[model samples]
Target: MTVQPIIFFPDQRLKQICAPVIEFDNALRTLTVDLLDTLRAAPGIGITAPHIGINQRVVLLDLPQSNMPEIYINPEITWLSDNKKQNEEGSISMPGISAPVERSVTIRFCYTDLYGKEHTEEADGLRSICLQHEIDQLNGIFWIQRLSALRRTRLLTRYKNI
Candidate 1:
């Protein structure tokens, strides 16, 4: 698996809504591997296909506490808890910046695996937050957008200066 180059924030491709993955084939498997490698190299907890300029619905997430990375293809949030939690969120595309973003404390999501099997899973805490963040990327929502407008502006300016 190759560690692909990350397309940083403000790139037009990052704003393009990703297309669903239709073919569960070797290419898809390769993309998954590449994403995992890229995320690991990014030293990040999560990443999405569009971050690397692949406009397909895919995400890789591996919290440091997890046994292994998770690859989600065409992942969609199915349910969200009424309760909310705030967690600091960063991005592989927009490195070195983070802010607390409010999200559901728990979520249920459906996704396809590399083998084409559909799976639904429930998550909470960091897993829940990371999944939501990655899915947002697949939907053309940058993580910074999750922040308050004032925070988003300040962070982007800081990112630009970096």
Candidate 2:
């Protein structure tokens, strides 16, 4: 397992649409390990393949290390709760910043595991937020995109100066 470098926000690779997982084999096993190591070293809860400059539909997420980390491969959201909550969300890409953003309190998703087995799971709390946040990466989006126009503008300006 290797700790991959995370590409910060404003990096062009972050915006690229990722490729789907194919040829699930030993290569994938290594990729998953690298992703997990990278996320842990990021000391972050989640990471998308593109963040490491690999345009593939994969992500790694672990909440504070207490919770077992989850790996999602070609993952898709299946359902969500109407209930929403705002939390102070941060990302390695953003460096030293975080902002409150609204997210669904519950979500259901499906994905193929490294062994090529399909699985579906429901998540809530930080897991919910993590899934939504990570799923957004599949579509080339960041949580900041969900912020209000005023807040988005302000954040952009703040980061620009940073």
Whole-model Cα lDDT of every candidate shown, in order: 0.90, 0.84
Model 1 root mean square deviation, Cα atoms: 0.9
Q: What's the lDDT for residue 79 in model 2?
A: 95
Per-candidate TM equals 0.96, 0.93
Q: What is the lDDT of residue 118 in candidate 1?
A: 96
Candidate 1: where is the Cα deviation over 4 Å?
A: none
1-162: candidate 2 lDDT, tens digit per residue: 799888889887776767889878998878878888887787788888887888888887877745577788999899999999998887878877789989989999998897888999998998889888878877888778888999999998988888
Top model number, lDDT: 1
Candidate 1 has an lDDT of 0.90
Q: For model 1, name the residue pairs that clash.
A: none
Model 2: lDDT of residue 46:
85
lDDT of 1 by residue, 45-127 (tens): 89888988889999888888889888898999999999998888888887888889999999999999988899999999899
Error of 2 at 135 (Å): 0.6
Clashes of 2: 0
